[model samples]
Target: MSRSPKINTVNEAATKYQAAPNEEYQLVEQAHRGVPAGAFFDILGFSGLTKEELSGLLDVSFKTIQRYQNDGKKLNALNSEQLLKMITLYQKAEDVFGDLVSFNRWLRKPAIGLGNQHPLKYMQTPGGIDLIMDELRRIEFGALA
Candidate 1:
């Protein structure tokens, strides 16, 4: 039986990978207060994205985002979810394209399967993310459009 994808939070991913060799790994039951607000920086580094672009994509203000970084506050549930999703997408893109640069380039161009929409623009919505992921799957299966 195939297991479904677990929509893990940033902290959950960290903890899972950080598990001690002798200990049983445990997934966090909830994300509340588990991830730092500044964890976006990690995602930004992995994705080679700018803070301004991410703020714009997530529809957050620069000053407010600065406060989150300065205060080291925990991201709220919604923001955490978005951050996790973006990281997951980046990882998948890397796996498929072999490098961040290639994946980033592909994200900026209009994809034929995506109705000629730049995949980067679709990162803002869950539905758009699903579409992009579907297109990636098609690419993997040699079903290029």
Candidate 2:
């Protein structure tokens, strides 16, 4: 006879992963709390996403995806493929949730300051600042790339 797979409680998963006491664990805890394997399968089915589909969408190997599901790997940040999917999802969600005008307004506002004090200071260079500026201007306004 085959042994059963281990089913982890939220507290057990959280403790095992040492997840910070924050929103990330809260989301998972809420979703998986008091849920059995059947419920887990039902939720995944409801999303209309197959394991293969999710693997492609996440741009991760199927094994990596399985690791997350079976081994309880914590995906704290979006990978490139996930980030692209999130951008598209956010765009659609915003349309249905009403205009995110206030959010876009911040992006349109002119950035204040130059040099190290500016938010874009990281883009600025300490060595050969004039040369870097020239190259950036050329790339931005000219086809010199």
Candidate 3:
């Protein structure tokens, strides 16, 4: 018996989250426990979103993010939940598109399914993240819409 290598995600914890994504209970629990501030920074870099954009999505100011980083604190529940979802979203996107470059390109381009809006424009809220996930699923299933 041979074991295949695990597909590494951008964030290790987010990979775990993605591994059992169907379990909403697990996701809620992780959200309640909060995520490390560094996780946000890591995802920010990997996500190709500017700090200002990411901060807007996470509902925090740039200074707040810097303060969290300086203090080495965990994010609050709301921010944590959104961050986890965003990380997981990026991981799935990279998987669907085959690479960070491709995914980033898709993110910036307007999609017909999303009313000809850039995906990045919809990443500011949790509901928007869910919408993007649906879009990714559509792409994965050869149902580009």
Q: Best candidate per TM-score, number? A: 3
Clashes in predicted model 2: 0
How do the candidates rank by lDDT, highest first? 3, 1, 2
Backbone clashes counted, model 1: 0
Model 2 C-alpha lDDT per residue in residues 58-78, reported as the tens digit of each score: 456667644554754444333
Per lDDT, the best of the predicted structures is 3
Clashing pairs in 2: none
Lowest summed lDDT window (length 10), candidate 2: 118-127
Off by over 4 Å in 1: 1-34
Cα TM-score of candidate 3: 0.82
Angstrom error of the Cα, residue 45, model 2: value is 2.4
RMSD, one per candidate, in order: 9.2, 15.6, 6.3
Q: In model 3, which regions exceed 4 Å deviation?
A: 1-20
Q: Distance (Å) between predicted and true CA of 11, model 1? A: 13
Q: How close is candidate 1 to the true structure, as a TM-score?
A: 0.74
Q: What alpha-carbon RMSD in Å does predicted model 1 have with respect to the real structure?
A: 9.2
